[model samples]
Target: MKALPYDELRALYRNFLHSQNISKATINTAYVDTFYLWRKGSKELFWNAVTATDFENEAKNALIKALSENSTGNVSSLVNGYLSHLRRFRLFLASDGTAEPSVLNQGKTANRAYTRKKKMDVDVPYPSIEQVEFYLVKWDGLENYHLQEDALNKLFFELCPKNTDVIDILLKASTLNDFYSTNIFSIYPVAKHICALDIDTRLKAGDVTLVGDIQYVTIGDIEKNFYSFATKYCSHHNPLDYPIYDSYVDEVLRYFRNRDSFSDFQDGDLKDYVNFKGILIDFRAFYGLDKFNLKQIDQYVWQLGKDYFPKNYGKKNRGDK
Candidate 1:
C-alpha cells in the first residue's frame, strides 16, 4: 500500500512519541517534516511502487532525492529521525495492528530526540512534477477560478485581443479588476491610458514598462499603479510569456527564496512583471522543474500560497485567483 493513504499517520506517530515521553520538540518535527514529504511530497506513482520489502531504505532514498536540493549537513540524522516513526508505521501497515508502535516501545524511551527550531524555516518539500501536479489538480477542482480563466480567455483572445478602443480596454480591465478584487476604484482612466498606448504591440514585444505606473486622464486626473492587475491582463493575453502576479505569487517566491535560495529577488521586485517572470524562470531552473511552463507554474505556486500563507486573504484579494 502507498504511504499516502495513511492520513492518520501523523497523529499516530505523534501519539507514539508522546507515549515514550519523546521530547515534544521531536514530536513536532515528526508532524511538520512528514507533512512536507508524505502530505505534500508523496506521489502516488512514487509511493505505489514502494512496498514492505526494504521499505525503510526505499523511503529514505525517496526522501533524500526529494530533498537533495536543500539537503543540509544534518540531513542524514534528520531523515533517520523522521524514519523512526515511518518504520514503525510501515510495520503496523504490514501486520494490520498486530505490530503497532504501542507494542514495540512499551517502556519510557529516551527523550534525546533532536528537535529543529520552530519556524526556523518552512518545511516545504522541493517542487517536482508530483507537487506541481497536485496543485494543478487543485486548480482544476478550485471554485470559480477555472471558470474565470475560460471567460477571460474568450474575452481577451476571441472578442477583443487588441486594446484599440476604450470599450475594449474598459471591459477587459473592469472585469479583471472586479474579478480579482484589485480595488481599482477609478478603472476608466487606466483603460483610457492603456487604449492610448499601443498595448497590443507592447504586449507582443514583451515590454517591461507595461508593468509599472500608469498616468491616465479623465475624472480628477489621479495617478495609480495597478501592477498586479496589469500582469494578470497581460498574462491572460499571453500566458506563455507574461506570467500572472499577485500577493500569493509574491509570498510563495519569497518563501522559496528563503527556504531553497532558488532565486535572489527582493519582495518589491515581484511588482515588476519582467523581473517577476525572470525570478519564476530562475525558480523553475533551480528546482529542476523546467518541465512545466509559466502557466502551469503560476497555477501551482498561486494555489500553494493560497493554501499555506492564509494571512489577509479576505481583506485583500490581490491573489484571488
Candidate 2:
C-alpha cells in the first residue's frame, strides 16, 4: 500500500535532497516548482506525461522561456537536464506509486534521458576517409566552413562500428565522468546504460541536451579509477590542462564542428544522459583514439585557443587532481 500521498512524498524527497547537500544555484526554479505542483495536483497525470504530446509541448515551452533568460548560454543545457529529471520521476511514479515525491525530486538533470526516440531515424551525412584526407590537404579551400559537416561525417564513419562495445565505453564513460564530477551521483548507472546501444542513432534524435566539456579523468574512488589510470599511465600528460575541459575544446567544436549539441551540454546534464553509440563511434574514430591512448596530441590540439584558456595552475578538483 502507499505510505503517503504523492504530495507528502515529494516534500519528503525535497528534504532528503537538502540533507544530501546538493547546491540549488544550479537548478531551474520554475522547473522544480512545476514538479512540486504536479506532485500535488494530480498523481494520475505523471503516467500520461511521460509519453504525452501535451506534456512535451508544455515542457518545451517552459524550456524555451528558461533559455530566453539565460543569455550566458546555459538555457538549453539546464532545460534538457531538468526535463530528463521530470521524465524519470514520472516513470517511477507510474511504477510502484509509492516513492516519496522528495526522493523522486532528488534528481538533478545531468544527462539526456530521451534515449528511446519514436520517430523514424534520419540519415546523417558522415564523411569518408578519402574526403577527410582531401580536406586536410586543402583545409583553407572552404571559406564558408560547411566543410565541418564533411569532416564529422568522415569521423563518424571511421570510428563507429555497425554495432559494437567500444562506443558503449566512450558514451558511458564520458557522461558518467561528467555526472561524478558534478556531484550528481544518483544517475551514474543510468548514464552507463545509455552508452550501450544497437545503433549510433540514439543520441542524434533525442530530446535532451548533448554531452560536452567533460573531464573524464581524476584521482580517487572506483568511479574516478578509469580516467585516473589512463591519465597516469598515458605518456601525453598536460599539467596545464589539469581541468582538461576548457573552453578551447568547446569553441573548436562550436565554430569548426558546428555541433551546437555539445556546445549546449553541461556537466550535470552530460552525467545523466546516454549518447548515440554511433556518435561515440564516430567521436572515437576521430578524437577518442588520440585521447584514449596518446595524451600529447589531444592536449596540444585542444589547447590552441590562447585567449580563453583557464589558468591551468589551479588545484585539481579532488576527483581529477
Candidate 3:
C-alpha cells in the first residue's frame, strides 16, 4: 500500500466525482471535510498511509465532539457523507491503478463508525387511512393540477418510456421535478439501466427480482437518487407493485420494526430491492393496510417520518416536494 500524495489523490477523487455529475457544492464539502481530517493527523498524509482505523477514529472523535456540542444529529449526517466520499475515493484510486485492492478493502471501517452513532427512536404511530386520504385529496386539488401532472408524466416517460403505468400514477400523485432537477444528467443513464432489467418477468413468476435488479438507482455512488425516483415512480404507477424505499420510508420501517426486532434497513439494503419491497408488503399486511395502495401506504409512512424524524425530514430537504 504505497502512499500517494494527498493533493494528487484528492484531485483524482474530485475529478471522478465531477465526471459522475455530482454537484459542485457536494464535491467541495466532501473535499474540505476529508482534507481537514487528513491534515489533523499529518500535514502530508497519503491515501494509502491513512488506514481505515485512522479514518474511523477521526469520525468517532468528530461524533463525540458533535455530541458534546449537541450537534450530533447534523454532524452524524455529515460524518456519513464524509465516509461515503472516502469509500468512493478509495474505490476510484483502486480502479485507476493508484492504490491496491487490499488497501481499498481496508476502508470498510466507516460503516462501523456510522453504526455506532446514537440511534433515533422512530417508533411513532403510523398515519391513519383518513390522514392519507386527506393528503391525497389535497395533493390532487393543488393549483394547475392537470398541467403539472402532464409535465411530470412527460418527463418520467421520456426517461423511462417502458414504465407507462408507473409514469401515469406519478403524474396523478405529484410532480417529480425535484428528482429531475437534482439528477438531470444521471436520470437517462439510470433509466436505461432500469429499462434493460427483467424485473417485470421475474415478478410475474412470483419471484422478488426487484431486490437484486435495480442497481442503476445508486449507480456511480450518487446515493438515494435511484430510490428517490423509484419510490415516486412505483408508488404512482402501482403502489402495490413497487413500494417506496426512501430514507423516510426506511425510518417508518425502523419505527415499526423497532431496534430489537430487526436492524435498521439502510440505503445499502435496497440493492436487494425484493427484500426491500417485501418488508413494505409485509408491513402493509401487518398493519392491515390492504385497503390502501402501496403509494398511499408510503404517504402515510412518509408523513409519519416527517412528524417523528423532523431533523431528517425537514421542510428544506429536496425530493418529491
Candidate 4:
C-alpha cells in the first residue's frame, strides 16, 4: 500500500468514518486534526534531506533548547507528538525525499500508542463498614451532594460492622508522610478522582495493589490510587459545574476525549485502564496541572463528561446506544 500525505490520509479517515455512520463529536474531530498537524509540523520529513546524524543532532539540539528554556508542559507534549509523528512519516517517505506512497501502509510498523488498549489489575481497596459510618457521622451536617457521606455511612455499616472514625484511622495509618498530610477521605476521593490527595510520601513501584476491583491500601498506595481515580471517575462522572482537581489536565483530556471524539466510550470510560492511568498521567504533565490544585483537576475532567456523556450513556443499555 502507498503512504499518503498526512492531511490526505486524515481527510480520508474522516470521510471513511463519516461513511460508516459514526456520530460526529468533538473528540473525533480533534484526533484527526491533531494527528495530522503533528505529522506535518515535525522534523521527520527531513530524513531524506539530512543524514541520521544530522537529524539526530538537530533534534537533540532543539529538544535541549526547549527543555532548558523550561518550555515543558502541554506545548512540549504536542511538540513531541509532532516529532514522533514526523519520524514515523519519514519511514514512509522515499530516500530521495519524494512522497511516493499515496496511502498508509497497513502492514508496516507497530500500531500507534493512541490506538492500543491497556489492561490493569482488577483489585483496589475500599472502606470498611465502620470507617464509612464514621465518615458519615462526621459529615452529617454538611449539606448537598454530601449525600456521598451518607452513602459511605450506609455502605460501611452494612459492610464492616466493627466501625471506627475514618479520620482517626487515616491519621493513624502507618504511612503518613512528613512531606504531605491527608486523611482517609482525601485518599478515597483521590482514588475516585473526585478530588486530589495531598501525599507527602513517594510510591515504591507495585506497592499499591488492586484486588477484585478495589484497591488495597498501604502507605505507598496513595499516588497510584489517586491517579487511577481521577482518570476513571473525574473525567467521566463529575459535572463541569463542580470544581476540578486541576485545570490543565482537565483541559487536555476534554480537548482530546470529549471535544475530539477519539474515545470509543461516549463518556470515555473512567473504569477503562487507558482512561484511569495513561490518559490522566499524560495530561497531568502535559497541561502542567501536576502541581496545581488536585480538586480543580478532578472538576475539569468530570465536568468535560458531565455535560456530554451522560446523555448518551447513563440511561441506556449497551445495545441501546
Candidate 5:
C-alpha cells in the first residue's frame, strides 16, 4: 500500500466537508482533532496505511478506556466524532481506490465495542421533585455563605435572561473554561446564531432548525454542540418554553420511559429535538412541575444523573453535574 501524505489526506477531508456545506468552524475543528488522534495513534501512518486494525486498536486502547473512566462522557464525544469522520473518510478513499474496500468494510466488531462502552448504564434511582426542591432550598440558603456555590447560583440565574448581551456574556464566559475553551473561536458565531433565533416562533412551531450557525461548533455530534447550546439559551429565555436534551437529562427521561410513563415514548424519539421538547413538557405537566422552571427541572435531573452515574464534577465546574 502506498502511504498517502497526512497533510494531503487532511486537505481532501476538508474539501469533502466543504463540498457538503459543513461549517468552516466545524471543518477546522474536526481536521485538527482528527489529525491529533491520528498522530497520537501512529505519527507515521499514512492514509492508505490506515487499516481497520489501526482503528480497532485506537478505539480499544485509547477511546474506550478513556470513556470508561471519565464521568461527564466528554471523551466519548471526541472519540465518537473522530471515528465517524474516519468511517466517512474511509468511504471516500474506497470510492476513489485510494484505499482497499476490504480494509474499510471489515466486520463491525470494533464499532460494536465502541458503542457498548459509549452506552454504559446508570442504575441509580430517580430523584423526586420533592427531593430536588429540598436540595434547591438548602443550596439557596447556603449559597450566600459559600463563595463557590454563590458563583454557581449567579451563573444559573444569569442564564435566565432573554437579553442578547446577557446571553453573549454567559456563552462567551463558558468558552473560558477548560471544557469548551478549545472551541472559543467558534463559540462567538454560535452565540450570534442562537441570539438571532426567534424564541416565540420556535415555541409556537415547536421546531428549532438544528442547522446553520446553530451547527457552528458541532463537528459530528448534534446533541453536544447545537442542541446543548439551544437548550440552554431557550431555557434561560423562558424555562417553561424549552427543556434541555443532554445525556444527563436523557437519563431522567429514559427512567420514566422505561417505567411506561408514556407508552408511546421510544428510544429513537429522543433524537428529534421537537419531539423531545414535547415529551419534556408533557412529563413536566404530568408531574405537576408548573411551580418549578425548566432550568430547575434541568438542574434536578442533572443532579440525579450525577448521583447515579458518579461522574467527577471538578471543583471549578459550576451548575453542571
Candidate 6:
C-alpha cells in the first residue's frame, strides 16, 4: 500500500477530535494550527510514515523539540493536543482511517496494533482457532461479572434464561440496552409483538425470518426495525443457532471481508440475520475455524472489535440508524 498522504490522515484526526466532543471553535483555532505546525516541523507523513511503536518511542521528544523551535505563545496546549491526536489517531488508524470513523464499519483491536514492516495498511492477523480459544477463555473468566454489559447479560439470563413467553422477550429488549428499552413505552410492545408470534415453533425450525419478524417493534404510528435487538433476542433463545449482530461484529466482519475476500456481503446484508449468519459461516470455513461455533465467533469478533474499533462503539444503549 502507498504511504498515506499527509492530508488524508489529517482529515481522520479531525474526525477523531469531533468524536471527542471538542468544540468547532477549539478545533478551528487550536487543532487546526497545531496540526499545521506538527505537519511542518515533523517528519514526512508523520505517524503514517512509521510504526506506532516507533512513534511512541521517538515521536514525543521529536514533537516537543519541533514545536518549541517553531511555535510562538503558549506552545504547551498545542503540544498536548498533538500528543492526544496521535494516541487517538492510533484508534483512528486501527479502524482503517476513514474520512469519518463510522465508514470503516469496524475492525479488530489488532487493526490499530503495530506490526512488523511491509504489512498492508491496517492489516491484522485474523484469529486462528487457538486465538479464538484464548478469547473464549477470556469470556469464561469474565462470567457472572457485575458491571456494564456483563452485568446486563447476567441480569438478562438470570431473569429469563429461556424465551418461552412475553416476559422473556421483554427482559431481553429492556435489559440489552437503552436503544430497545427507551422506557417501558418501547419495550412492552416489542415484547408483545414477539410473543404474538409462535416463537417456540419458529425457533425450533431455525427460521431466519423469525428474527426479522420480531424486529418490527411498532409504537403509536411508526414502525422501528430493531434488527440488532432481534438478533440478541433470538440468540438468547438459542445461542447455538443464532449469532448476535452488533456494531463491533459488523466492523470485524467488514474488516475481514476487505482483508481476505472471505465473502461478497454488502453492509446491508449484515443487517439481515440470515445473510449475517451465512457470512459468518463463510468466514469460519475460509479461515478453517469450523471447530468453533457461531456464538464463539460472535464472542471472538466482538472482543476484537472492542480492542481495535472502539470508536463510536460507546454507550450500549445507542439508537439504530
Q: Which candidate's lDDT is highest?
A: 1
lDDT of each: 0.64, 0.35, 0.49, 0.33, 0.50, 0.61
Between candidates 3 and 4, the one scoring higher on TM-score is 3
Model 1: per-residue lDDT, tens digit, 118-167?
22222344466677887898888966788878888999999989888899
In order of appearance, the predictions have TM-scores of 0.66, 0.26, 0.43, 0.29, 0.43, 0.56
Q: Per-residue CA lDDT of candidate 5, range 1-321, in tens? A: 235577787787676655543334445555665554456545444342335467656543454454345422234323444454556465665565344323432354433332333432222322345556865665556543255434434564564334246375444335333332233334555554555653345544434554222434543364344545455444434455566566666766776554324335777776566677777767666555657776676667765655443445433322233
How good is model 2 by TM-score?
0.26
Worst 10 residues of 1 by lDDT: 108-117
Give one digit per residue, the lDDT tens place, for model 2 in 206-300. 32222221224222333432333222111111222222333343333332233224333343321332322232233335432322322232233
| Alpha-carbon RMSD of each model | 9.7, 19.9, 16.3, 16.1, 17.5, 14.1
Task: Give the per-residue lDDT digits (tens) of candidate 6, residues 40-77.
Answer: 76545464423446665465665667666765423433
Per the 3 Å backbone cut-off, how many clashing residue pairs does candidate 6 have?
A: 3
Give candidate 6's TM-score: 0.56
For residues 1-321, could you state the per-residue lDDT of candidate 3 as single tens digits? 235577776786677655543344445655655554465545434343334557556555653454335422234323444454455555665465344323432444433333343232112322344446765676556545445556655654454434425443333223453433324343454555555563445433434445344434565766543545555544433445666566667655754454222335564564456667777777666544577776667656765665554553334232432
Whose TM-score is greatest here? 1
Error of 2 at 240 (Å): 2.1
Candidate 1 — which pairs collide? none
Report the poorest 10 consecutive residues by lDDT, candidate 5: 117-126
Model 5 spans with C-alpha error above 4 angstroms? 1-129, 138-185, 195-225, 260-263, 285-291, 312-321
